[model samples]
Target: MSETKQSGSPELQWVRILDLDELPEGRVQTVTAGTTSLAITHYQGKYTALDNRCPHQGGPLGEGSIENGWLRCPWHGWDFCPHTGKPPGGYDDGVPTFPVETREDGIYVGLEAKPPRIRTVSDVMVETMTQWGVTHVFGMVGHSNLGFADAMREAERAGKLTFIGIRHEGAAAFAASAYAKLTGRPAACFAIAGPGATNLLTGLWDAKVDRAPILALTGQVDTQVLGPGAFQEVDLATAFNGVAEWSQTVLPSSRHAELMSLALKNAMIKRDVAHLILPNEVQEMPAEGKPATTPEGRVTPMEITPPAASVEAMLKLLRTSKRPVIVVGHGARFHMAPIVQLAEQLNAPVVTTFKAKGQISDHHPLGCGVLGRSGTPIASWFMNESDLLLVFGASFSNHTGITPKKPIIQVDYDAMALGKFHKVAVPVWGEIGITANLIRNELGAIDTVDQRPEVRARWAIWREEKLRREKDDRGRGINSASVFAAMNRVIPENAVIAVDVGNNTYSFGRYFECTRQSVLMSGYLGSIGFGYPAAIGAHCAAPDRPTICVSGDGGFGQYLGELTTAVKYGMNITHVLLNNNELGKISKEQRADELEVWQTSLHNPSFARYAENCGALGVEVTEKARLDECLERALAHEGPALVEVRADALLV
Candidate 1:
């Protein structure tokens, strides 16, 4: 410890920043004291401290050499006296100086006491976000976004928000999207101007298409250089036009709090992406004591009831049909309780689209697992045999194979989503929960046949088939069936599982049986690299819930750096990685199309070892016998964990 030397008033804080001999003769080194940057210079056997920023163009004098007895500004060659911070021409624009003393143990520099913190525009905007219930933010800090980043830092310190600094901005966006998808609330993703801003597009698109609420905060170049093609300048508003439900640039004269309130309101209300662009200068502008906006009177309860006539029409089909089947999608995630109750009232079998895998537990008496490509035969059989198809909160995507031939009753809150693809017998425009309850209350005694026995029979058949598949091994690697079977036995019932796109996800949908787990995915966009980052988001959104990620080698390889991110935050996530040593799904598609399977094979490092290197528990499962044990160990590990399964490419 260095002895303190107070050179000025009692407010001067003497902080020992460098050890003795840390600086040699005629050298300058940069140091920091309570957010203030200082350049310590040693000349003529004396030590001195000066403001690190050069008077000209705010360049760093500490990064320059003491050439010809003057500390030069590396950016523009502007020079100042090494010891006194004065220009040779006696110019008035000289750098400021601070008191420095060589003490017994080290060098001590005296800094003026930090002033009381003042709120900036970023604070007002960020406060509005928190008031709107944004609890988490993921992003990378860069030069342009420093002001906003500092505001988030303060918010984090205050425990009002949690900020996760991710490895890549794309991962940040994916994490935010998954956070929203799992929580039904918006989480913010931040990025700097130009490339950083553009990197968030793919994940934002995933949120946009899947109807997940997400807020994107992007930094921009100075407003003066916005249109002049300055460095790292892009027309962000135009760039985000398609993805964002609402996009605006924060201007000096804008109502900052109102802007943030509107951004978050639009995101939640529309269930889509909202963007705010912060210019470098405007983000640091004085707030002038403007109060942040809250969601007190801004948002309304969204339990919209269907029209009586529409409800009657839906009941007409339900009453007449003997075999009714209920299909759900990612949109029905929040209203499954009422939907499941209505399904039970009508004795209808409930099947989910791939994106809605865990909306209803596969073990439910009426549950028929996922439908379409990544689905069980039971779901397909039930859907095909049903006379009436009652789909709630589903878009009828072609991938889901929701046939239009059947008498369909589609329920959705968004009017545009009702009968979006083709015509339906009855289109109910209301909140899914309210509409479902209304239907159940009105339909007193329906003559619909009990589908529970048939659902049970179908599940038995599917499980038997899965068991048979699990037993078949061609000596290549572990099969996906056994992998998911182990996961079914090990993962927590209420865990949040983020699945990536590939054969592994296909197997997860086909084989994994859920109790009450929440599933997250890039539903419409079908993007890769979503799993691990999404697990990060899920853990952040609900830290109490166990988080799991299911990914193939190809998908996991995309954002492998995020493994380190999970370890850095000590996020408890069990990642089940299916290492087929290939892009198994694409290879299957290639063969189905009668084309050559080229560039589908992958060469990967041992992901288990990689996880260990990243400071997390790593377990490798090469045989089916060890699947359960490795999965159990990985799930039981305290921090982030990875269970890499070497699996047969064709077994999926």
Candidate 2:
């Protein structure tokens, strides 16, 4: 019998693979030593360690059964001598064997030390991403994407970026979308080929319709097998057509860093999804000293000022109006400081679209709250009474209910967004902040109604109604009003709140009054499983701020596995889970449509206990009295926590 080199080779380090009698005779088991997977076989009183991969199709030999004194490959049925790591006499291809030693304590195998990483295409591209201010990545590392994932691992080690491994690719995309929505900066969502890449579609569409900047990196099969149908191959370019503003496949001869730079540029400039498909082989190609690029000279300043004619037309309408109201939307979120200043100057009431709920504090004197279906009566009243509507960065979506009857002066950075739905008195095209400042500068004095007293009175009426609803809860569960009331008290004023779809979202829109908290939601898409993952993203975007997730039972169940992710990363997030044990929103919709509410119910476990099982603080609130205490405890937890509120479905 031939044995591995008997003499010591200092380069190969010894690693224990198993203990005595661990593996039964004639059985093969898998083990790892120094990042190398090996098939440890014990047959005929001798143990041998061979490389785990089958030479034919890379099938795992360890998983194969020993039949007739030979190990049969599980995938292809190819046979090799179990003890000698050799195939049939006619075949010359044999599996590489590692030196195995049996000792009194355990069995050990020798492996070479891991080598230093060589710079690859993925490395240069990742470097460019960091240089362009891509600080966070949400992804799942899978077989096809290992090469790129390795590069990301190195970036994480160097502290250039943070990589969050999520339970699903959809969560990764939603997280990236939320991060960009909150920070106005692009964050990347990564996934492997085929199903993993396709899983990101819903969230990518969410980002696309809402005009949020997001970068999507997906793995592809080898370039050689791209045209024909290889395993896990999907034509990513055609698949990402409408969702991604820019999509490209990384090639061996391509300028890898430039592709990354362009992807980011398109995302930033268009406020849309940008995708890159990395072929497995191309990701590991030698960078060959190719330099990474940056946004320093590549990007132009984004402060676009309004045209002279448009500004004049806007001023003419503003100067003559007596009861002017300023409406803002999601696009206006980051530029609210100046917009609020302008609102204060005109003594105009400021209302936001549902997506822009927390752009301006509800406590501000001029802030009138959200508009449309998920809006405050205060906002509706003011908009109905206004003589002129000064809409800034707001798309005239039907959900927003921006009154077309009132003379409208709409301002937007995108020329296409201006007067998109209907003709307005003036559709001023300019960047929101610069335009609002210019309008403030150009208008010396403005005449408008002082709507503060009306705003205060409306808020008082709503609060009274909320208190009444909170008290009249049936014997089913605690009212959502009480839950949000507790949140208004316990949630940090400067927190970032990610809300999910369904009745919980409507309740949040109606009941949760923002002080300084930033609210994130699946706005245009209204996706249900967005809350917890978005909270994860918001935390990544602003780690210093308190992060919270508000979700209903049905919505929370969609991505409950992400709780482990939050726990693993020690994300300081307080999840307010409203558990009604049903898809309350769908039930309500069915009833509203005069149809029987079927298939809207859900089976749920003890979510609080589940959180605890996932290594997080868990508190369940069954009674109204316990609501405040439970929320306070969860909010005060040092790490990921869940407060499950057994909420009444009808109360929302």
Candidate 3:
């Protein structure tokens, strides 16, 4: 705040507004003195000041035209006296007036000392999000969410959070979902009202169905215009009804940080989408110095032991079966070592669902590769010969059919996921790692049959079949099998691979044998543009891990702009682009269903050249002979790189 001061008059507290020469005579302009905005008018060789806002809809009086000595509001044509801020009519209320004076160097406005900025609701909530370990946010900042974005900006400046501005809201959501999938923790996505908010649906559904925890922060129109259709307004809570496990709108009356606490807790405990909508005005409302919330005592330990009866049932099934096998899904990824120990105790073959493709190495003595539609003959043969299925954290999706007739003992952390589609002989609802240990403890040395020889025999048969097909190139382009063979040879043992949905993905699932790599995919949602964006998240989650992304011509085209983002961040991603110049999966489905494959073919640019234009290493592989050299170069590159392999669409 400042006070008016003149050379010949008593001095009061005064703050500089603008240089006297800056405002011409007979003109009015808006200026700021700390938090107070003023309309400084220069008329009659003197200066006067008034509040800049008009009472009529809060329009800027300074922007109004001075006609007939009256300042007319530009928004609605309301009038006020230019010097006195008095309306032309007998209106009781007008803009407030402030004292002003001229100094040698500048014009000064009279007020008290400038006040410190008030803490805001968004500030409290962003601190709470930080305390909950949500360090990364992916989204675009927009007008509706400017206040919330400002809070994030402050936190980012303070090094408490990192915000990645994205080209699309949908990509933000996918990146957040993939972050959660990779780290088993919550990351946030942000958007403005209407279309920006709605763009997050597909990725939200991806996290929801796959049981990944994610937070969505959306901006809404002012509460007053919510129902009357303000410019970008939409009922965000209603729009997110089924997708988010919990959703709420922030209000001035609400506990600001508590709302954020609940959103984070719900996402963490439920392992699903949690959302918060910040109304425009409410987001900027003063928090009055309220403290933030945290997860200090909010979360509980997740691991639990199975019931005694279920454990006994599992033991009995394991002891009696001549051929028992263990099957894990994406849900079991974090607890692989314990399950592998249990597999060794029973000499059982371990197979994975496609989503869990690289949980265990294919070279492991007991590892029988993936089991399902995108599976190998080794897994199918082992499953057919098994008498009991020791299922762990696997959802029996139709794509990965766990035979109903087999005697089964299913284990999972979520009670709802235990034999969700059908009944099992033993449904053990316990944490995966704990239950695996319990099974191993009870069956100390159960003289189980050694199935290692059979596993080796099956692997030989599958490998022989794969080799026979690898040479079946039709001369159109490189064969799918050959490309994957090159990948299996080039990618590191500890690489993280994100595969998109298409014929290329199917080939990856079928032919790319894992040594110790981890695979991430869209899984239940099976969205197309997931690979490249997910690779970004994976790189962020484990910066030291070699990250690889595989996508088809159609899938990569969807989020093609993300390549620049990879380059901007210098993410170490070796993107394997299999270009067949068509949506081969859809074409195959149409042909199999007795329909003409219409609109499935596509037009594509040279993705390798595109990557080069984006400042990344790019290699084009048209022949099988060039694949190894190209892949080696790409994987060894320091920053982001791409290997575009032209392939035969029909071979997949």
Ten-residue segment with the worst summed lDDT in candidate 1? 1-10
Query: Which prediction has more favorable lDDT, 1 or 2?
Result: 2
lDDT of 1 by residue, 133-211 (tens): 9999999999899899999999999999999999999999999999999889999999999999999999999999999
Give the runs in model 2 whose Cα sits over 4 Å from its true position: 1-6
Candidate 3 C-alpha lDDT tens digits along 311-411: 88788878888789999998999999999998988899999999899899999999999998898888988888998999988889999877898988899
* lDDT-superior candidate, 1 or 3: 1
Number of backbone clashes in candidate 2: 0
| CA lDDT scores, all candidates in order | 0.91, 0.92, 0.89
Q: RMSD to native for every prediction?
A: 2.5, 1.9, 4.5
Candidate 1 runs further than 4 Å off: 1-6
Pairs of colliding residues, candidate 1: none
Residue pairs with colliding backbones in model 3 are 1-112, 1-113, 1-114, 2-110, 2-111, 3-13, 3-14, 3-110, 3-111, 4-110
Q: After TM-score superposition, what is the CA distance of residue 185 in candidate 2 from its true location, in Å? A: 0.9
